[model samples]
Target: MSAADTKAVGPPVPVPPDPQPTGKSSSDDAPRVQKRKRKKGELLPYFLILPAIVAIAAVYLYPLSKTVIMSFQDMGRRELWSGEPAPWVGFEQFTNILGDPEFWWVTFRTIVFMAICVTLTMGIGLLVALLMRKLSTWVRLVLTVALIAAWSMPLMVAASIFRFMADSDYGLINTLIAKVVGEDWLGHNWYLNPVQGFGIITLLVVWGAIPFVVVTLYAALTQVPQELEEAAALDGATAYGIYKFVTWPVIKPVFTMVATLSVIWDFNVFGQIWLLRGNKPEPEYETLGLYSYSKAFESTSFSQGSAIALITVLLLSGVAVYYLRQLMKTGEVE
Candidate 1:
């Protein structure tokens, strides 16, 4: 049994049988493939959104950060060329702006103007919307077309149109007045005094804004249940009562949202005033927007201008804070 026989009779080394395929190999490959696909699926949304994120960062974030940093620093003509960071002045620009009486006056004027413009625009818009609800379909179509045209008109064009309409010699209003009343009122300046000037500007802004208000409010009005008004009316409610209880509440949220937007817009109205006054609107009627522009470009005071802009933004944020908090709490916006 020893060495000679070992080759012939050695305990059979069990040559391991070739493993049978359980078909698990193909299934295992399938799971790996599925995992790869899952990874790809997870990454696809991010890839889709990456371009938007990059675009936003480039357009909004970069400029916003630059403006914010520029506001805090003494950025001027030298920094514009030197390509170096300007000296950081803690609140000096802010102080200069705050200390100026002209800033205070402009701030007050802006608030007043915003209040008046928002009121008139919303009021007139609401009236137009209510009228639209009662109008014949054909008339509604015509009015809607006209409104779309008005709304689509550029701000500069609108301002120019209004300026011509309110012009001293060849103005439509004065010409009509002269034809009806007397030639004495024909050559009168519609924009002579600051009060009159502001009024004219307000008229222009409100005229432009009303179409938007009419469209949004009219849409909201259509959504309001007519049955509620009828029910209230049938229950011996007066017209005023029905409107007060039924119509107002339904449109209140939308009205509020639109008004807020209007205030924000009108408060920062530069193009309207600038173009209306032929680019030299009296300082008395100027808003913070115009003030900032005058400082940054006209006076070459970029830091001060940035400070004023920051202030304006802060002020608007303050106005919107309540609505924003309410929106967040409700998880809804009108």
Candidate 2:
């Protein structure tokens, strides 16, 4: 305990203060890290969707934009003398389409054709789908294969086959009719009359369209909850009643989708008509679709043809908007 020893010992060492964070607590730091990770995770989804968005913009939007632009310009064989730069004729094409009696006639025919084809296809498809649901697995498989085979056939090939079958001289239809009616069925052309031609076209279109609808409806039907159906049955409802109350409501969305797709397809129908009637505007059976093709290629009125196409687009778009609104309302109700 000498003075020298006490001085050497000095005061007890002071404890060092804990280090402080720059601006954040440990808890705050944890949240920041988590937020950064979440931001990264959110970006991954957009990156995945970017390719699809780009592809759609390139493929669909670009062509649609071109069509819109072309529809506004008077770029036809007759209009070439106007200038290298086709003059902007605002809505002249639209006005022409509206004014033309032939356009109106074709539009009416198109609507009637679409209505008949869509109704028949949907009805037959639903019936077939219902039948499919009750079938044994093997039978269902066979039927599905057969249906897909029919659906997978090339459109041109199908049309050619149908044309052959419908021919006046060598057609299976005529042969069958002769066998039954004891007359020369091959003496007259089936497609010479507009009504008969349309009937045959309707049959062909319906046959081609039904397979897709059947597949879609059947998938939707199978997804219906068995529990709901059974509960419906227990409530003393008949089979039809159960279906009406329970199944139909469940399948309504799918029905709407099918109907919308069918309408679009029907509006754009050109191949079938072209195959049946070579480019000529039939006296009573010209559709807007066929009319557009004939104008563009056969008549060589590109601007007018483009105008017809735009009119068809507008018509279909109106229909689509109506159905989309209905679909949205249905979603809200559900």
Candidate 3:
């Protein structure tokens, strides 16, 4: 071939060296690498919550376990002071408490009291919330302030004030009643009758609880669609009917939650009764908490007290589970 016809190869174009390769395909390794990273990310959340979990276990779980253990033992002042293991009675404490007529009566009283307080709290709270919705800006502000004040008052202080108001001598309420009814109300003991005494306590509880319920319900109410309410009204629905059809459904979840909470709190009422009855609540005033306290401290039956408290916890747990189920049904909880 002629030199002019020869093509220039340029040192054979230096063929690129074969790309280096690992034993594994890159695509196959990708997923495994991603999985390792994902696992590391997942662990971060649990690590972040570890402190909270530890605190809860120490504060709540520890005491709860101790109470459960004590319930099965014959722990008394002796064992409590000496820090010695009490004799294990193995459900005898539970058996005795469950079999006792007084225990049953106390439980019954507690349930009744809880029902009354919850009903009144829910009813009054809802009414107040509705009223707040209708109120002008200034009136609602005033009402909110009043509610906050009531809610901020300490429980002991509220109980003491109620007790003083119901005092046999020189009580403001008695003086007002005497003047209004022209009857000899001064020096009249309200605690002489159990029914009257409990009624007063119920009032005190409802008063303190209404602020929270009203605030929560009112917040929920504000989120309700006014257009729906107006449409219902235009369809010839009464106010109550409009509320039932449009308003209630929107606030029902909140209402249910608050009512359940009220049941829990009222069922555990101790301070109010204790203070109202001069710190020595009579047999007639014995609810589950008072009964438990009396059994533990007054009679030095710590095991029986623990058993009663455990029973109360079980009862409250049932209420809590029901509330959780309701929330789940409403898609408010997972």
Candidate 4:
């Protein structure tokens, strides 16, 4: 064949230019493989958290179980002195508590107190957080520190101070009231009146609890993307409309959490009532917390007190679970 024809109709043979080694390491590949290995090794974090889980179970669950068991037993000094096995009395304590008129009254009072404290705390906290959001950083920090200082003070100390301040004879409040409303105010015994006493306790509780709600709500408020609020503003939404639509929806979960926690804390309150009212059942303001303590310590019905305590725990747990489910729902939506 001619050279041109041979070139145009060449044989279909492939060209072998380079030979590469198989199963050989490359410099760039080593770091990538090592990074993958490092990631696989990082599963130890979950194991490290196991200790905290065990500690919580030991501290809270163990005592809760013991309390539940003791609620069924006739546990008291008499049982201890006799050195005899206390017989199991299933549901008797619960029934006695349920049947008692005083229990219902105390429970209602507790509900009212919880409602008042939770509402006031959440409302005031949200208001303060909104106001603080507009302030300078230094002012916000100072106010936050002051609120936390109030919250960090011991509950007993706060209750004692409130009690002293409300005393008709020597209380600073009474002195001020006397000056404003004349000397007749000095004769009024604030502690002796159930309404007045409960009102004071409610005020103290609200004051102490506002800090937690405020801090939590403030943090949640800050997390609300500023862009969203700006967009709403551009859309000609009113100030209240922006809050209701953009700001509130973002912080609703935190609000729910704070409210639930406030309810739980208020329902379980013991210090203020005990410090103010002693063991006597105030006809208008007796709370289940005080009633339970009185039942167990004063009346020596330990089983009944345990039953009441368990009921309180169950109610609070239900509330916590409900709100947690709501938080989870919010997360899913986001």
lDDT of each: 0.87, 0.85, 0.91, 0.84
Q: Give the C-alpha miss distance for residue 162 in model 2, angstroms.
A: 0.7
Query: Distance (Å) between predicted and true CA of 176, model 2?
Result: 1.6
lDDT of candidate model 1 versus the reference: 0.87
- Superposed model 1: Cα runs more than 4 Å off: 1-54, 326-334
Taking all chains together, each candidate's TM-score versus the true structure is: 0.81, 0.83, 0.85, 0.82
Residues 24-85, model 1: lDDT tens digits: 67767988999999999989989999999999888888767777877888878778787887
Estimate the Cα RMSD of every predicted model relative to the unseen true structure. Answer: 8.3, 5.1, 4.6, 5.3
Give the number of the best model, judged by lDDT: 3
- Summing lDDT over every window of 10 consecutive residues in candidate 4, give the lowest-scoring window: 277-286
Residue-wise C-alpha lDDT for candidate 4, range 72-177, written one tens digit per residue: 8877869757877777999888888789887888888888888988888888999999999999999999999998999899977887888788887888888998
- Model 3 residue pairs with clashes: none
User: Candidate 3, which segments miss by more than 4 Å at Cα?
Assistant: 1-50, 330-334
Which has the higher TM-score value, candidate number 1 or candidate number 2?
A: 2
lDDT string for model 3 (1-25, tens) is: 6555556423355689998985889
User: For model 2, how does the per-residue alpha-carbon lDDT over 1-334 read when each residue is reduced to its tens digit?
Assistant: 9999999999899999998867877887898899999999979989999999999998989767766876787777666555577778888887887898988888888988999899999999999999998999999999999999999999888888988888888899988999898876866588878889888889889989998999999998988899998998998999999889889988888898789889999878878887777545475767887788777667766677888887788889977997888778777877
What is the clash count for each candidate, in the order shown? 0, 0, 0, 0
Q: Cα miss at 160, model 3 (Å)?
A: 1.9
Clashing pairs in 2: none
Task: Put the candidates in TM-score order, highest first.
Answer: 3, 2, 4, 1
Q: What is the lDDT of residue 89 in candidate 4?
A: 93
